[model samples]
Target chain A: MSRWKPDGRGRLEKAALELYNHKGFEATTVAEIAGRAGLTERTFYRHFADKRAVLFPSDNPLPAILADATASAPVPLPPLEVVTHALIEAAPVYEEREDLVRQRQAVIAANPELQERELAKLAALAATLTQALRERGLDTTTAALAAEIGIAAFKVAYERWINDPDEHTLAQHIRETLDTAKHLTTPAEHAAATDNVSFTGQQGTA
Target chain B: MSRWKPDGRGRLEKAALELYNHKGFEATTVAEIAGRAGLTERTFYRHFADKRAVLFPSDNPLPAILADATASAPVPLPPLEVVTHALIEAAPVYEEREDLVRQRQAVIAANPELQERELAKLAALAATLTQALRERGLDTTTAALAAEIGIAAFKVAYERWINDPDEHTLAQHIRETLDTAKHLTTPAEHAAATDNVSFTGQQGTA
Candidate 1:
């Protein structure tokens, strides 16, 4: 949780999120956010490119952190597991910032444009993670599938973690969500449960 | 495999995709698309809301067709299997539109703004499919997981199907991709291959 501080960027972000929620994103302007933060428009611009930038933060290091973690795995892991481990390792970075994270999610949810940007951001993260996995020497399709599964785990886990009343850590939620998804895909279960359904793989080759 | 009929909507879509791909999405306008299609600007607006709408048809029936297919399944099926079947039944609808589909993909890939709209559309499709699954008596988590996996399969399969020179059917690609994703999650394989890794469900669970 963030205690409102005198720090310029922190104050501006808190103010912008609050204002955006209260008055709606379109009606709220840069000057009002700056005024609420007890700062100037010049100071707000110094921290972010514009009103939208306050919430999105163009310089956010998440993609780089994720890619670095995936690239530096000391052991050879299944592509998805490698990305999963990388995600958990990077989880702590956001543990302390849940308040801001929640606020950002709410703001993005309320606005379609913001929601689009959020998805584009997630896509970019997945793209970088895919490249990192490829650099680890996995083939193109494998790298893509692994990165996508990892990103899907991250997205679903973050939603559950934020929503759960028990207040579990982000890493725990990620692990649990990843575990559930992995189980859904396992071969042993697939054989037992999928007998009623016929697969094209059973009939033809690509 | 489409014969490119002279229908109004078809002509408009062809003209719009060509203009968007040629001049870029932002640079092209509704009037240009109409002019190229031999229609009036009013006719263009009648077909689409604006330039962006031209790229993503607002009234695409795939969601309804998919939801209907899922709801019409005669027997109880696993949530993912229900979706896989729905996708296959829906495949025949697009089998003849490969050329337009490929053009649309190229146009969307070239524009970030168009890409954002595309993501929003997919999210909307997922939301509707989730609702459809929930209507079939699945819990929220099961519905969400099933819908997300269905969308992922659709995405990955479409990409591979389009890129493959042999032109395998979309339904075949979707089934194969689903199978591959399922295999990635098997416990038996996890036991043998992932000694360095730990999945929480590795111990137990469905």
Candidate 2:
């Protein structure tokens, strides 16, 4: 076998997920993942720290992409609007990885430990968004609240998108979920004007 | 040694927190906790499943109390209002254990494993609240969004209550935090009329 295989990381991830699905995450080993990928264990370590790391890569770019999007969003937008912009900006990152993301979510759903780590990852993303907003001059309370709401909307949208039969874009689901959240929170009398608040210019019915 | 110690569970919890704080949670052992509590190891096992259980008791009553309060809140209340009522109802549970709660927070703060468990606990509480709201006839999306928002407010209020030098009550913090969340999410054009929506009748300024 060749010492260097192109796209070694991709191969390892594909193999790891397949193995994890076929033979539980805990029972699978690094050696098996590498062997299945047609690579060596050394290549596996070069790509990921361990089996779990294959699912949750440390180089995940979603956090930085979101923080940058928040910072660059049009000024004077409410914090949630800023966060919504960030989600729309970051949605493209998930566009090409729907299958992988779905598989990872399935693996996480079956394991309690992975579920905790996934929650921590989402919480860390929210914290990053909060800090980014605070740096943009929002108060701590407002920043944190907006970040949490954004994550909640993202979660709802993700659930809907992953299970959606039509294969709609993640951005579309995000827009719909945010609308649902806004509608849920707004008192009934004020609900009539819900559409007037969309300043993102990218809004469309999901 | 007496086989029966009054308040043995409380003693075990107190001793476990002290030992965990001093020696770190990983380095601490069940026997040591039992010894520190002036109880036998059997008594320690009887009160808690393990050292970690001292912080996260299986019988934690907040979930049931919050769910009950959600179910019984005055009808026609919005989902968020119902959740807020549940939180207010559960606030009294923390009133008598201020010091223990604070200590537990510190211990959990010092340990990542414990922190994960703490996050799981909060997430589970959110799930419970969501189910309770769904049982109250709200749609799944609305119920989930309200529950997530309520938990976010609870987290903010909890951090403030634990760290506040003024010793403000958790109920007060919850009310204030909910107002802050409401204000943060409300559009700026409609911010002035926020107080008009308070139909809970239990509202108070923090």
Best by DockQ: 2
DockQ of 1: 0.14
Off by over 4 Å in 2: A1-4, A187-206, B1-4, B186-206
DockQ per model, Cα:
0.14, 0.29
Candidate number with greatest lDDT = 2
Candidate 2, A30-110: lDDT as tens digits: 999999989999989988988889988999999999989998998757667888889999998888888988888888889
lDDT of 1 by residue, B32-142 (tens): 888898888887777788877766777888888888998997544666778888888878767778888888889999988888888888778778888887787555554
Worst 10 residues of 2 chain A by lDDT: A197-206
Clashing pairs in 1: A186-B185, A186-B186, A187-B186
Compared to the true structure, candidate 1 yields what TM-score?
0.85
Candidate 1's residue-wise lDDT over A26-113, tens digit each?
8999999989998888888988999999877888878888888988886546666788888898798678788888877888889999
Q: Each prediction's TM-score against the native?
A: 0.85, 0.89
* Cα shift from native, residue A157, model 1 (Å): 1.5
Count of backbone collisions in candidate 2: 0
True contacts kept of 2: 0.30
Top TM-score hit: 2
